[model samples]
Target chain A: MDFLIFQIPILMVQASMDGILLGILFALIAYGMALQWGVMNIINIAQGELVILGGYIAYFMYMAGIHPAFGVIVSPIVMYFVGWGLYKTIIFRVVDRDLFISILATFGISILTQQLMNFVFGSDVVVAQSNFGTTMLFNSMVTLPNSKIFAAVVSVIFAMLLVLYMRRSKLGRAIRATAQNARAAKILGVDTESVYAATFGINAALCGVAGALIAITFTLHPYVGLPYTVRSFMIVIIAGLGNLPAVALSGMGLGVFEEFSDYILGTEFRIAAVFLLLVLILVYRRFKLARKREYLK
Target chain B: MDLFKKIFSIFAAISFFVSLALPAQAKVEGDTIILGAAVSLTGKYSTNGEHTQNGYNMAVQRINDMGGVTVGGKSYKFDIIYYDDESDSGRAAQLAERLIKQDGVQYMLGPYSSGLTKAMAPVTEENQIPMVEANGASRSLFTKGYKYLFAVLSAANQYLEVAIDLAVEKNGGNPVNIAMAFEQDAFSQDVRIGVVEAAERTGSTIIIDDKLPKELNDMAATLAKVKATKPDVLVVSGHSKGALTAIRQISEMKVDIPMLAMTHCDASKLAKQHGKNSEYALCAAQWHKTLSYSDSFFGDGQQFDKDFNDMFGYAPPYQAAESAAALLVYKAAFERANSFDKEKVRDALAQTDMQTFYGNIKFNDTGQNIAKPMVLFQVRCEGDVCANRVVAPTKWASHELVHPIPSWSTR
Candidate 1:
C-alpha cells in the first residue's frame, strides 16, 4: 500500500513535467496561427509548412558551421522576408475573398511547400546538434535541454512583447484598427494593405522561430509538419480565436492532459482524449451561450 | 484489276499481324527479370525506405555487372520496378496489388517500416507473390502463418531479448527497478511488451512503464521522473527523434545507469547528434560493420560496407545491410526454385538454409528467421572518432563489458 501511494505521485509528476515542456512549444506555434486567423481572418493552413521551412533554414545554417543559437537568430528574419513576399504576391489578392477560398488557397500553398521541401531535402531526417543536453536545472533530475527551454522562453517573451506592441505602439494600433474595421482605418489614412502584409510577415516569422526550436527535440522530416498544423488548428479553435494568452494556456493544458492520458490510459488513447476534450468544450460553450441568451431575453 | 487489289490487301494485313506480335515476343524473350519495390519514398518512413532502396540498388547493380543470376542453364538480368507509397499503408497495399497484377512481377521487396509492411502482407498473400521484408521487425507479421511472407531481418522480440540478457547477466547489473520509455507505435509497442515480459522472467521489478507520444519534442520532465525512480536499467524503444531526445535528456539529468535501446537508437547518427554524451549507450543489432562472418558465395558485410562507402560517399547504415541481405536471400531462393513461378519461389524461400551479407540465414515454418546472429554494441569515443564497439558474444568484444554502471557521483 505504501509503495502504491508513492508510485502515484511519481507518475503524476512525470505526466505534469512532460505536459508543461511540450505545452510551451504547442502554445508558441498555435499563437501564430491565432494571430493570422483572428486579426487577418485568413486561415493560413500553410503555417505548419512555414515551421518546416524554418527548421530547414536552421539545419542548413548549422551544416554551414553556424552555431545553433546563431542559426535561431537568423531564421526568423529569413522567414519574415518569405512571409512578406508571399503576402504581397499571393495573399493580398485573396484577403477580402470568401473564407473557403482563403482556406483553399492556403491549403494549396501548404501542399506546394511540402512537396518543394521533399524535392530539396530528399526526406532524410535532419537535426541541429548543439549543447542542448548539458543544462540540468532541477537538481540533476528535472533536466531542460538548452534549446527547448530557450525556445519556450523566447516564445513567451515574444508573445508578451507582441501584446505590448499591439497595445502601445502606433503601428500596432493601426493594425488592430484595420483588423476591427478596415474601412474605418482606411478613412483614418492608415495603409491597411501594408499593415496586413506586415502582420502576415510577423506571423510567418513566429512559425519559423517555433520550427527552429522544434528541431532541437524532434526529427525534421517533410511530413511531420502536417500533424502539427492540425494540432495548431485544434488549439486555436478550442481556445477561441484572438485570445493569445488563452491560446497559450489551453495549449499547455492540452499538452499536460495528453501526458497524463499517456500515463494512465496509454499513448494510443491520447489522440482519442484530445478529440473527446474538444467535443466537451464545444458542448459546454454552446450550453453557456444558450443560458446567456435566455438571461438577456 | 480486282484480283491485283485483293493480293495487295492480303499482303498489308500479314505485315500488320507480324508487327503486333513483335512486342509480345520481345518481352518474353528478354533475359531480364523484374523485382517490384513498393517503398515509402516521400513521407514519414522515407529515411528507412531510401536506405533500403539504396542497398537493393547497389546489390542489383553489382550482380548485373557480374553477369547476372545464372539459373536453369541461363543468366537473367534484373531490373527493379519501384513505386513510392508516400508512407500511406493503404497506398502501399494498392501499390502491392498493382505491382503483382498489372506489372506482372513475380517477387517484391519491402515497404520498409513495419506498418507499411503489414499493410502489404495480405495483398502479397492474396496474390501468392513472395515478398522479402527488408527492415520490418514486427513479430505479429510472421505469427499469422502467412507462407508467402519471409523475414530477413531479426524480429523486434529477438533484439529486445538480447538487450535484456546483456543488461541483466553480462553487465552483472540487477534488472530490478526497470523503466521503459518508448514511442507509441506498433514497433515500439512490441519492444515495450518484450521488456515487460523479460523483466518478469528475470525477477526484476518494473518501477515505471511510460509511452511518450509520437513526435514528442520535449522530454525534460520525463527524464526527471526516470531519474527519481532511480531504475537500475532504463530501456528506450524509439526511432531517430525519440532516441536522440531520450539520450539528450538522460545526459542533461546526468543520471548514469545502464541503458538498453532498440535498433533505432543504435545508430552512428544518434551518436553524432548527441556527440560525446552518447557513450555507454547499448543496443542489439542484426549486423554491425565490425562483426565478422565466414566468407562464402554470398558477399561479406565488411567488404560490402567498403564498396558501399566508396560508391555512396558514406558508410552504409545497418538498415542498408538488412536491405541488401533481403535481396540476396530472394536471389538464392529464386535460384533454388529454378523457376520464376511465384508459388515455387515462395516454397523455396520457406525452406531456405543459406548465408548472406549479414550471416547464416534460415527460416522456420512461421516465416521467421531461425538461428539469426544478434550483436550488442556500446558507443565509445576513440580520439576523435566515435563508433559502436561490438561488446557481446564475448568473442567480438574489443574491451571487456563494463558491469553495473558506476554511480553518477563517482563518474
Candidate 2:
C-alpha cells in the first residue's frame, strides 16, 4: 500500500514534466491565435498554416547546410516580412467585416497556403535535426532533451517580452486600448487601422517563431497545421480571450495535466483526458463565477 | 453563280450535320490504356501519397519507354488518370467512382492510407475494377477476400512479428516482459495485437499495452509508465510523427530497455532527427540498403543508393524502396498478363510468384504479399554520428545484434 501511494507522486511528476514541455510549445502558438482573435475577432484558421510556412522556411535553411539553431533565428525574420506583406494586402481589407466572413476568408487562405505548400514541398515529413546534448537529472533517472528545454526556455522569454511590451510600450498600450474599445481609441487619435495591421503582423511573426521551435521537436508536413490550429484555439478559449499570461499558464497546466492523465490512465486515454479537462475547467469556472455573482448581489 | 451558291449551302449544311454526329459515332480508341490513381495528393497522408505518385510516375515512364503494354499483338500506351482525394475517405470513394465510371479507367491504384482505401473498396467492388494498392495495410483490406484488390506490401501483423521474434531471441533465453504503445489507427492497432499475441506464444509477459492518440506530441508520461512497469522491451507502433515523439521521450528519460518499433521508426530520418538519443532503438522494415540481391533488378544496393540520391536529392527512405518494389511488381504483372485488360492484369497480379527489388515477390489468395522479407535495424552511436544498421534475422542482417540494451546506469 505504501509502495502504491509513493507511485502516484512519481506519476504526477512525470505527467507535469511532459505537460510543461508541451504546454510551452502550445502557449507559443496560442499567443498568435489569441492576438488574431482578440483584436480583429477574425478567428484566423490560417494561424496553423503560418506555423507550417515558418517550419518549411527553417527546414529549407537546414537543408542548405545551415545549423538548426541559426535556422531557427532566420526563419522568424523571413516569416515576419511575409506576415507583414500578407497584412498590408489581404488581411487589411477584411478587418472591418463580420466575424464569420473574416473566418471564411482566412479559411480560404489556409487552403490556398496548404495547397501551395503541397505543390512546392511535395508533402514529405521533414525534420530539422539538432546537435544539442541531453541532460540527465535525479541520478540519471529523469532525462531532459536539450532541444525541448531550449524551445521551452525560448517560449518563456518570448512570452515575458510580449507581456512587458503590452504593459509598458506606447504602441502596445494603443493596441490594447483598441482591443478593448476601438472607437474610443480612435477618438484619442490612435490610428486603429495601423494598430490592427501591426497586431496581425506581430501575431503571424509569433506563429513563425513557434513553428521554428516546433520543427526542432517534431516532423513537418503540409497538413500538420490544422491540428495545431485546433489545439491553439482550445488553449486560447480555455485560458480566456485577451489574457496572455493566463493563456500561457493554462497551456502549461493543460500540458502537465495531460501528461498526468497519460501516466495514470495510459496513453490510450490521453486525448480523452484533454477533452475531459476542457469540460471540467469550463464547468468549474462557470460555477465559481455564478457563485461570485450571487455574493455580489 | 446562283447554282454554285446553292450547292455550297447544301454542302455546308451536310458537313454541319456530320460534325455533330461524329462525336456520338466515334469509338473509344485502342491506342490508350487508362489506369486510374486515387491518392491523397493534398491532405494529411499526402507525404506517402506523394511518394506513391512518384513511384507510379517512374513506373509509367519506364513502361512507356519500353514501347508500352502489348495487348492482342498490338501495343497500347498506358496513361494514368489520377485524382487528388485530399486524404478524405468519402472523397476517395467518390473519386474512385468517377475514375471507374466517367473516365472508363479499368486498372486503379490507391487512395493511399488504409482508411481511405477501405472507404474506396466498396466502389471498386461495385465497379469490379482491379486496384493495385500501394500503401493500405489494414488486415480488413485482405480479410474481406476481395479478388479484385491486391496488396503489394506485407500486412502490419507480419512485420510486427518479425521484430518480436528478433527481440525475443536477442534477449537471451529469459522470458521477456513487454510493453506496447500504439497509435489508435488500424495499422498500429494491428501491430499491437500481433506483438501481444506473439509475446503470449513465447510465454513473455506483456506489462503494458497502451493505445495513444495519433496527434499526440509528447510521450514522457507514457514512457515513465513503461519504465515503472519495468518491461524489458517496449513496442512502439505508429506513423513517423508518433514514433519519433515516443522515441524522443523514451530516450530523454534515459530508459535503457530495447524498443521494438514498427515501420514508422524504420526510417534513417528518425536517427537524423533525434541524433545520438536514438541509439539502441530497434525497428523492423521491408527493405534495407544493405540487403544482398541479384543484379538484374536492383544492380548493387550501394549503386542503387548513389543513383537514388543523385536523382532525388536525398537518399531513398524505406518507403521509397517499398514504393520502387511495388512498381516492379506492377510491371511484372503487366508483362505476365500480356494484356492491358484490367481483369486479366489483376489475375496476373494475384498469381504473382516472382523475384523483384525488395525480395522474392509472392501474393496469397487474399492479395497480401506473402514473400515480403522483414529486416530489423538498430540505431548505434559511434563517437558523434548515429547510424541505423541492419542487425536482425541473421540471414539479412548487415550488423551483429547487440543484446541486453545499453544500460542507463552506464550512459
Candidate 3:
C-alpha cells in the first residue's frame, strides 16, 4: 500500500550497500560450489548446511567466551574434516556415477545435516555477534554495519587467498589436472581420488568461512541451509565453473538483484524472486545454447 | 529444454503433493462427550502444537478428575478425539470435517495458528458445531460473523494496541516515529495492521514499514534501513524467528534506536543468549505469572504457570493458558445447558460468562473475548540475570516501564 523507497531515496543507497555486502558473502559460498563442481564434477546440495554448521562452530566459540570473528579461521578447519569424512563415507561413492545420484545423495545429506543441526542447535535463530559497530556515510543517511563491511572484506580476502592457493599450491595443481582429465591425471600419478576428496573438503571449508561470516553479519537457523544451497548452485550455473571474476560479479549481481527485488516486490516474494531469477537465467542460457546449435545446423 | 523439463517436473511434483486430499472415515456412538480437535502435532507449529495439546489434555484430565461434565443428572467423561494436522491448514480443515461429519463430534477446539483456525472454522460453522479455540487471535476471524466460531484469547489486532498505548504514554506525549519489520504470515500481518492503527492513534509516524524475508532468516537489510532513518522506536512483528533476527541484527549492526518492541519478544529466549542487549525490549503478552486471575479448575494464574512448567518443562505461553480456558468455557456451557444436545450446548456457549486462570471469559457478540486485556512485558536485566516483568497498565506492572531505551553507543 505504501512505497517507502520512493519517499526515502537514502534507502536506495542503504539497500544497494547491504545487497552488495550480502552478495559478497553469497558469492563466497557459491565459489565453493564452483570449485567442487569444476574438480569433483558433482553438485553438492549440502553447501548451505556446511555454512550453517560452520556458523554453529563460530556460535559455539562465541558462547565459550571466544570472539566470533575468529570463527572465520576456526570453522573451516573443522568443516574441512567434515567434508573429507563425508567424501570418504558417501560423496566418494556418488563420484563417477550419474550427476543425478550426486544431487540426490547430497540432498539426503542436506536433510540429515539440517535435522542434526536442529537437534544440536535447538532450532532457535542464533547469531554470533562481531559487534564491529557501524560507519555512517552521507551524514548518517546511509548506515553501514562494520560487521557486514568486515564480512565483505574478509570474503574478498578469502577469495583472493583461495585463488592464490589454487595457482601456487601442489594439491591445487593436482586438483586442476584432475578437473581437466581425471583419467589422464590418474595415469600421471596425480591420485585423482584423493584430489576429489580434497576438492570437496576445500569447497566445504569455503562454505565454512562464508557461514561464519553469515553468523556474524546475519542470523542462522538449522533449516535455512536450502536457500544458501540454491543460491550457490544458481551462482555457479550463471558464472560457470573455473571463472573467478564472473562468479564474483554475478554473485554481487544476484545480491543487488535480491535487494532491489525486496524493495520492488517486497520481502514475501524475495525467495520466490531468487528462485524465479534462477529459472529465468537457465531458460535464457538454454535459448542462447539452442541458437548456437541452430547456427551449426 | 532440459532445464525447463526439470523445473516443470519439480513444480508438478510439488503440486501433486499439495493437492493430495484425504478421505474422512469415522463414526461415533456413545454417552461419552466427544471434543474433536484438528491440532498441529508436527511441522513448524509443532512446538506451539504441543503447548496447545497440553492445555487441552490437562483441562480434560482436570475436568474428568472432578467426574467430568454432568448433563441432566448424567455424568459423562470427556474424551477428545484429536487428529494431527501436520501444521497444514488444508489438512486441519479436512480433519475438522472428519471430526464433525464422520465421527459425529459435536464440539471442537481450534488449531495452533490463526491461519489453521481460519481453515478449520468454516467446516465447524457449516456443520453448526460449536468450536472454541485458544490460540487463533486474528481479528478477521470474528468479523466474519461465523456463529459457531469462538476464540478464548484476545484478538490479534489488539495485541499491539496496548503496547502502543504504553509507548506513547512513555514517550511523554511527543510524536514518535516507528519503523516496523513484520513477517508476511497472517498473524504477523494482523500485528502490522494493529501497530499501524495504534501508531496513528498516538500521532506517531511510520517512517519505514518493511516485511521480513519469508524465511525470517535475515533482517540486516531492514535494520540497516532502520539505522538510516533513525526512528524513535523500531517495531518487529514477525513471529519468534523474526523477532530473534531483529534483536540479533540490531546488536550486530550497532543500530541505535530509542526503543525496540516486538510481538514475540517474550518467546525470543534472549535471556539465555543476549540478555544484556535484550534489556528493555518490550513485548505484548496475554498471560503472565503476575496476573492474579483465578478460576476453580486451574487455581490462580500463577499456579497454572507452575503446573504447566512442571508438566512441559517450559513456561506455558498465553496459547496454552487460553487453550485451557477454552475447555473451561466448554465445561461451563455444558453445565449451563444441562443437556448433551448440540443445539443446547451451542446456545449455552453463546451465552457463556465466567473467569479462568487465564483471564475473564466473556464473549462479545462476534464470539471474541473482549474482556482479556493484553499486558505489556519487558526484559529486566540485572547483571547476568534477566527476567520478564509486566511493565504496563500500572495495575499489571510488576515493575516500572523502561522508556527511551539507551542507544547502542550509550550502552
Best by TM-score: 1
Local distance difference test scores for all models: 0.76, 0.75, 0.83
- Order the candidates by TM-score, highest first: 1, 2, 3
Q: Score the docking of each candidate (DockQ).
A: 0.43, 0.50, 0.37
**What DockQ does predicted model 2 obtain?**
0.50
Name model 1 segments beyond 4 Å from true.
A1-22, A132-141, A168-170, A217-219, A251-275, B1-29, B170-175, B266-268, B294-299, B406-411
TM-score of 2: 0.86
* Candidate 2 lDDT by residue in tens digits, B218-263: 6676577666667777888777877677666665566667654655
The candidate 2 chain A region of ten consecutive residues with least summed lDDT is A1-10
List model 1 lDDT by residue over B1-411, tens digit each: 999999999999998786655423321137888888888788766777778888888888877787777779899887898999988999999999878766667688887888989999999888777888877788889789888888887787766666676667754565567777778788888877777888878878877666767756445544555666667677877777677767666665576665645456554276676666676777677788766663343357678888899888878888888887877787778789898777788888888987776777888887888867677777777765667778887776766666565555564
Q: Where's the lowest-lDDT run of ten residues in candidate 1 chain B? A: B20-29
lDDT tens readout by residue for model 2, A21-84: 8899889889878976888778889989999898888778788888766655677777777777
Task: Judging by DockQ, tell me the better candidate of 1 and 2.
Answer: 2
Write model 3 residue lDDT over B204-296, tens digit each, in one string: 888777776666477766776676668888888877777777777677667887677778765556655566768888888878878878977
Task: Quote the B-chain TM-score, candidate 1.
Answer: 0.89
Which 10 residues in a row give candidate 3 chain A its minimum summed lDDT?
Answer: A118-127
